[model samples]
Target: MQAQKFDLVSPEFKRNPFPVFSEMRSCGSIVQAKLPLIGRVWMATTYDAAVDMLRDHERFPQQAVRNGKKNVAGIKWWMPKALKVLTNNMLLQDEPDHRRLRGLVEQAFMQHSIEEFRPRIETIVDQFLDELELKFKQSGSVDLIEHFARPFPLAIICELMGLPDEDRPMFSRWAQGITNSGSIFSFLSMIPKLWKMNGYFTQQFKKCRVNPVPGLLSSLVSAEQDGHQLSEDELLAMAFLLLFAGHETTVHSLSGSVWTLLQHADQLEALQANWSNIDLAIEELLRFLTPVQMTKPRIAAMDMEFHGQPIQQGDYIIALLAAANCDPEKFDRPEVLNLLRDPNPHLAFGSGIHVCLGLKLARAEMAIALEKLFSRFPKLHLAVPEKELQWKKMLGLRSLLKLPVKLA
Candidate 1:
């Protein structure tokens, strides 16, 4: 029998996806699906198949099927031309191009280099927690998303990007506009803000070229000025991707961890009993939560058989990372939220050369944020019931709209 078809963005899929994902897994590792706006896609519903698709970039290229310069299925035709600069980003490149773009900033994100920022991150967390505590005392409850989760990583990214302190609010606004790109209409709604953000980054690049300093943006400027390794558009695209991704994913990751920890008291108590279980606990949470639910469509480079399934050239392929993370074959008791599930190699940050560059930094930030939040507020928990809590209505991202908590 042919596999069942699903609407990737349906409200049913958004509410409780695991059961549906399990159904998808049973149907086949690769199930046919339709996404809003962009038509058909092949959703990889198992761990091995998802990894195979992600890691094999040669057969499944990162770049979308483009008609000369136009994207085959991207932004709408009416959107302004300025937003096209978002193309050529590292995540959308392959081969030497991907290697070159990723290498430019990988040094700064090296685990060791990121380790240097641990103390700073801790200090930031404590500072935010202090305010969050005050808010809890005054209001009797706190929205963790607004109070801590959002600002925690945003501050870090601002410092890393050398964004001025006053400009963080503006940057946050622009990022919200950019990451809310669920459909063509939503993206269309955000275009004015996107254009503003693009122009802002463009101006910053020009300024950085004249006056370089010690930060990722400055590093890009130095590389461009010294070796001309990056073009103007590439530099803008890199900065744009970093700003949106650096804080956005981390914010969702932190909030999702907190939400699940609060819900699963056993897991929460487990982590509290042995803080050393943090590393393992986080891995499990990442696997269980899988912040990035699905990856961008990786088009088939040529007509080929993918895992016994016939795929044609230019066919859209999507790896259901959330499904893969929870695959029963890959992890023992994948449904159970076991905090100490070692060897829990989840596809949260994805795989292959296009893997998330900020993985280490994200891990460090999440560790510190969760540790301090729990320690400071042992009785910390959800103010709203699980069903009442809202998840962002995004097509491919699993994130909370807000996490209201009583930090007493």
Candidate 2:
């Protein structure tokens, strides 16, 4: 198959890449594309192909060859020191280090442990929505992203990390600064912001060390007593990863799911009327919206043929989950929202050994939030037309900048 030219950074494509993805999918299951900011890479747009690439980490490794000299030069001049502290986490690591780091953090996100937090999560959601209802009554408008989408995840993650409630607002600001979709230099500017975040977390870790709280951080600190403890740097990296991954992805998920539902009122009504199907609704939403559209860059360890296309070793490949989730071959009427979808094997959370460890937790959080949201505001509707909604371009993730909605 001939390679399809896909400019990942082109302004038009970034604004909405579905057309480009469809074009590529028409060409073949896998197609080579050159991305701006980065260079040549392969884009996979089929469900089976994406799942295969993600699952077979042995063939396609997570760690990319860092242009160390360039990175150092850039960091020295442009990057903030604190960002350097937080960027060295599991997301960027591979092999023994990645395995070690993930193992240490896995205990905190175990199924039972996440289930134990449900009541707390439910309480938090109730408070946020209740407050939103009041605000809606007063102003008749609310930015869902700010009022609920962002804070819901931020509060949950902070609580999970054992970070003090008083510091959450600061943490939220720092996180937004760091993850803002913009130029590399613009993003690098968030280094100092992240550094401040790291400082706060470090102090929190110390407090946990002295008077260990029963949170993820405290549990990680206690892991050392069992002989598999992480170094301070590793521990800090784990904490940073959990916070960023736990909250940011869910923020986008919440926003994207709502945006999608607004676009498909029939599905939204179906879900509200039959709350029992919320589980499937959540699954379909995760698949359809695919908030985490791109996976970490994967480098081919050896030359391999993916769906008849030759992929050379050392070449980078990005599994486009959003594209694959909507591939017609995998999903019937792929573009239309269907809450009743079954056999939905979407790679939204990813696949294989590196699959999102927080998958269950994220689902539970979204399901609970959506259930409460719809129940509390059955007359909820978008305050702005879909065209007026702005989407952040250039960010690795696709999310609405703001979702204006009114609680009736």
Candidate 3:
């Protein structure tokens, strides 16, 4: 029997997606599905399929033009021209372009480089927690999303990008606009904000060129100026990609970890009892939570059979990362949240060359944030009933609208 089609953006899926994902896996490793803006495409529903699809760049390239087709996955006719600046990022590139774009700023996100920022991240996390504590004292409750989740990573990314601290709030506004892109109409609504953001990036690039700063942006600007490494559009695209992606995913990852832990009190207490294995525990949380559910759409490079599904050249392919993370074949009792599930190879950060660039920074930020949050508020509990918690209606993201918690 065919599995029932599911709307990724629907509240039902957001509330409890495991059952639907299970049904999808039962059908096959690959399934045909329709997305809000991207129409019909193949979805990699199991771990093996996700790995296969993500790693096979030759067969399934990100740039559709490489497949001898012109139907770009997410780009649409109605999309504002200005928005093209953001899509020119490395995420949508293939081969030489991808390698070239990635190499330009890869050093800053390397393990050792991110490790150097650990102390700074801890200070920032502590400062935010201190404010959260004060807010809880004054108001008797605090929304973790509003008070900590949204601003914490934003501050870190802004500081890393050499963006002024005062402009951090404006970036949050722009981030919110991007998160609401679930449907064509909603996406259209965000165009104006995106245009404004693009303009802001242009201004920042100009500033960096005139007076080089001490962060990643200035370095990128220098790369562009010296021997014309990055083009004007690519520079703007990189800025948008780094600033937007740097914080947006981390925000949901941090908040979702907190929510999941609160839901599974046993796991929460287990991790709290032994903070040394936080790195392991976070892997489990990332797997269970599955932030950034689907990967960026990959286009088929030729007519081929992918896990028994005949995919035409240029047909859009997306790895249902959230589904793959929970595949029972890969993970034992996949539905259960296991904090110390070692060898837990989850695709939360994807696989292969196109994998997340800021993964190291993201992991470090999450570790510090989670450690301090629980240690500081041992009595922290949800302010509202668990069922009352509302998630945003955005597709490809599992973000809580608010995480109200009480502090003793």
Model 3 misplaced regions, further than 4 Å: 1-4, 108-112, 224-228
Candidate 2: give the clashing pairs: 82-195
Deviation from native of the Cα of residue 212 in model 3, angstroms: 1.4
| Candidates in order: C-alpha RMSD to true structure | 2.2, 2.9, 1.9
Please list the C-alpha lDDT of all candidates, in the order they appear. Answer: 0.81, 0.79, 0.86
Compared with the true structure, what per-residue lDDT tens digits does model 3 show for residues 285-398?
Answer: 999989889998898888888899888887888999999999988899999988989998899999989898888889899999999999988778999998898888887898
Tens-place lDDT per residue, model 1, 252-283, is 99998988888789879878988998988888
* Model with the higher TM-score, candidate 1 or 2: 1
**Clash count for each candidate, listed in order shown:** 0, 1, 0
TM-score per candidate, in order? 0.94, 0.91, 0.96
Top of the candidates by TM-score: 3
Q: What is the lDDT of residue 239 in candidate 3?
A: 90
User: In model 2, which regions exceed 4 Å deviation?
Assistant: 1-17, 65-85, 224-226
Model 3 per-residue lDDT at 392: 81
Q: Which number leads on lDDT?
A: 3
Q: List the residue pairs that clash in candidate 1.
A: none
Descending-lDDT candidate ranking: 3, 1, 2
